[model samples]
Target: MINCDQTLSISNGKMKVAIEGCCHNQLEEIYKTLEHIENGENIKIDLLLICGDFETIRNTEDFNSMSVPAKYRTLGSFYKYYTGECKVPYPTLFVGGNHEVMSYLWELYYGGWVCENIYFLGYAGVVNFGGLRIGGLSGIYNDRHYDLGHHETLPYNTSTVRSAYHMRKYDAFKLAQIKQPLDIFLSHDWPRKITNFGKLDDLLHIKPYLRQDIESGKLGSAACEELLFKLKPRYWFAAHHHVKFPAIVYHDERTSSIYQSEEMNSKTIKNPDEINIDIDEDLENPDEINIDSTTSQPHISEDERRDQIPCTKFLALDKCLPGREFLQILDFPEANGQLEFSYDEEWLAITKATHEFLNLSFNAVSLPRESVIQSKIDPELRWIRENISQKAVGLVIPHNFQPTAPAYGEQQTFILQKPFKNPQTEAFTRLLNMSNKINPDGQSRPQE
Candidate 1:
């Protein structure tokens, strides 16, 4: 059986680590890359973070169960790790992406061991690693099913398979409840319009083709944007689009006002005996509040204030491909084990009260669709619906524009490549070669 008792601790010094764009069943290549860095530079990676598309197919059964087209289905390297044919060389943590073995990941919905030394972060989760509080939300955003719960089950049919990738409202609600600061936040897709914050010219220069999507404001996830605005984590890492992009998000008074408003509103409940919620106070009203410069000023040094103001640094890397800027190493000070793994009390109370008021059970699987729709009119549920419904503002797309269609259809032709030349296979070959080179003694060394 895989070992799940690995201790997590980080010393006072800066933690050196490796980050990958997407692990599309390329675990071996990722290990080899880290191994190369470790052997060549004499540096140890404390952890490895994969943004998503971590296809952990264990065998033919898992391969058949995956939601990919029949022709695309093939068992990758995960089979070895699952069966103990090979073991992960280092501690690895990942979130689910669009293309994943959902059946396997769904079994560990609350986050648990995928195999020895590898972890799936669940639908949404916060885990402490050597004092650093790493929070992540798995799955991308799809507005059509944003409010829907995870009602899909195994042996997924065509519709359910697609639904598996969409982010659920419950997970998003739980994440918003986190009051503590997060050291890092990981997601599969970039927060919508995050590009507006920094170095846009550089990004556009590199990936000029994205100008249409960026300009049209159809690029990323709006739900992620709301969470970023609310939580303001130190560093946000994502992958889906497969490009190396970076941005600095400024924590303005607006974000602070929204948070403070929620905190204040939640406290205004005088008679705890009743579950009466004020819809007006609960919904975010950005224009109603004025920033009071005097009392609102944080008690911190100027440098610290500056650091906390334009605080969040957003980094997105390209997909795992050789000679690409898909891998990155960064340093972070030890969190000193100060991280706490708990839900925000207020959020939990609100979620609980709302459910109780609606006479809805946790997961509410048995509730009728009509009852679920009618429950939204309740004061507390209404507050949740209104508050989380903030869509991307000012992003206008041409009505004639079809995202899936080629812009210049007459001039463009698409070709499907053979399986041998597939990028995943290439990555596997690279990993195999690296492993062989590293194991000159012909003995496999467990990555730590």
Candidate 2:
């Protein structure tokens, strides 16, 4: 039996990936930077992962919909790619940030092509790339709306537009139910109290303003922290608080890997006492902590204690701009170079199983009781095994790219509101026989 510290299986060969921070629509500079790195190192980057703030502004309506001030709201290079004026050089995947055009992203809420070769990771999703089980949660977390269902519709008001990207409980809960291990997890916000594990002194040396938020435990996301503790992925990458910070989260107290880079400075940044970090109830729990509820994912076997250490290598990069450390290229030589993009069976089952409980109401509603959701999945799992698990190339993610909305035109400022539901999302939901909850209106449509 695999122990708690063990990760999911790797692929036959390796994959080269470039991880980018917030993409404030600086497409030219980002590609140039990647080319510079590739030429300098004499290597190729297979995939590009943008953490958030990708600013997929296609038209003037999208530009108007973005939650930015007047000066910062200009449409950038994304429209050229959307209109076939240019093509993305590499396969790119990104989550939504607060600064995204919610009109387009919500249309692809179940995750679909923004255009050819560019994919949105949905509100929360898990997929396989080069044998790495990559899981990502789009949008940021807000304490005020964390427990509420998605309430914002298109033609958003001042408040709804901002709350549109606020991470919802339904999305987070879906992610927490994942039993399969994740290799890489991308989140826009840093996990709360993450400052404790990394070099705090070095971090403060640059962003001194963080000290107050760090001391008060006000910075980072509680939802992210809870997921970090719960998932324990091999590597976690984030961006939102514009800074390049690295840290090591050790699952087993006794052991840790010497992850290179400057998470910890040469010797030490300073003594732990210098910056106060609160180690609360989450951290106090040991590696083999059990979920006691019916929804508990019992992946690790009984022979799990003390054979090896499990740790999540956490790194967060800065937004795209001059003079900021916003990109890093990582190589997964242990991955399966043979496999193309495939769907994760467990995630698909989880999605199908929990589709009924998918909430789209506009008010603060508590998540369906764990026992209720668990009961729903038990029967659905059998259907999944018989249908999804039995076909040839069954879990392969279909190259489903189509334009359901109008494209950016020359000098085209104002376009129509998103009227048609994204064809990609509609097809994906239809494939699983799940109800299409995404709509122009924030509320779910009546079930047939």
Candidate 3:
């Protein structure tokens, strides 16, 4: 529970409402739940933020791209919304999770409207709503393919479909460049070791099965952890683990590894006096640093260094399940002005670099003439082949290899069950009940 006094002071008198959780193809249920909160409880929600696993399957064709078991493939309620048979009841925004229609999401890699009022945050994006800055990183972390470029093409093959969920390094890099304050941040997976900030005993009591993973530190994402440390947003939300857990991260105590790496790189200039490094001229003083002669590094006192001490409240909700704790309504202050979307410049640069290296024609080997004409006409594609394809000299695919599923061991089996019930749902329900009792009338309560 967050204290109402503290939250209201920062909200600037604007009522920004949010419903945090995974939709899991339950758009109608989510809408009905919002209606219940508004009409029944007399609470009006302004913004709906679904963490992920939304399953925005627009039609039957999208079903083929979903990473689900063959028998479970079908267009869900998203078809109705996509066809304009129904409309989103409110302003809705979402990110991609491990389980989704990658084909449809990939088409909007830069972030775009899925329907009238529904927006997908693309691979990674930042947008302003009601004057509040919101940032998001879609997909989960996978170490194996984290550094790889997005080479997966249209009409995705079996392996590429699964590969689409792995978080890329470029997306994380783009997120790192946001130097402004973020009111809220969203991701499909939790930051690694975030459970340590909250009551682990309480969490374990509800979902005893997770003890092994929690103790072994085998849960959540390292990439997300780095971003949390760097950004330190006011509120962080996630859902893939399907458990409603709240953790407050104090940024002052945690130093970002990215900053440390940069410091190390800057200090690694061996024999600086011997090298003629080009130094950018400062407007006030052109000779800020002498390029002809090396200068000793300046030492600064502790007070001169930048300090990041803001606290971030991290909350993860369960997947949509009846009688479960899957939704929350929190008030945010109004935005400073009209809302607008901005693409990450670092991400755009990465996209161009990736296109330079991996954008080869599909028919390069089978149809030479057609490939040549297509390449010649498309300057971007030609640049990719001429500059990047030659560098992939010894690339080889493992024989009879299959990509690993996102869920591990027992969790994988659990997801395959006919009537699947995520293990974290029950514990989350208990936690929510406890919170409700403390606040009773749905008012904010102080966090312990």
Instruction: Name the TM-score of candidate 2.
Output: 0.82
Q: Write the per-residue lDDT of candidate 3 for residues 1-448, one digit (tens) a residue.
A: 2321132111223454565578788888777766765554455667788899989775454555778888867556876676567877887888989988775676556555666677787688776666566788999888777777765644567887787777886677657655667888999988988877665665777778888877787778888998998888888889887776766665665443311110000100012122212323221211233222445756442222222235677778787776455776666644444333333322333334332223122221221242443333345334434543435531111111111112111122212111112122222223212221111121121122
Between candidates 1 and 2, the one scoring higher on lDDT is 2
**For candidate 2, lDDT tens digit of each residue in 1-448?**
2333332221222577778888888776787777665564567777888899998887676765678987888778887778778888888888888788887888888787887778888889987877778898988888898888776776677898898888888888889887778988998888888887777887899899999999999888888888898899988889998888877776754322322223422111111122111212121222443323367566552234333557687878888776566776666776754445667777877799877767778776566777887777667777777777688867777777765445556544334444346767777887787887776343331122
Please give the CA lDDT of all the candidate structures: 0.58, 0.72, 0.58
C-alpha lDDT of residue 152 in model 3: 60
Prediction RMSDs, each to the true structure: 19.4, 9.3, 20.3
Return the TM-score for each candidate structure.
Answer: 0.63, 0.82, 0.63
Error of 1 at 439 (Å): 41
By lDDT, the best candidate is 2
User: What ranges in model 2 sit over 4 Å off?
Assistant: 1-13, 253-307, 337-339, 410-415, 440-448
Candidate 3 local accuracy as lDDT?
0.58
Model 1, CA-based lDDT: 0.58
Top of the candidates by TM-score: 2
- Clashing residue pairs, candidate 2? 11-335, 11-336, 12-336
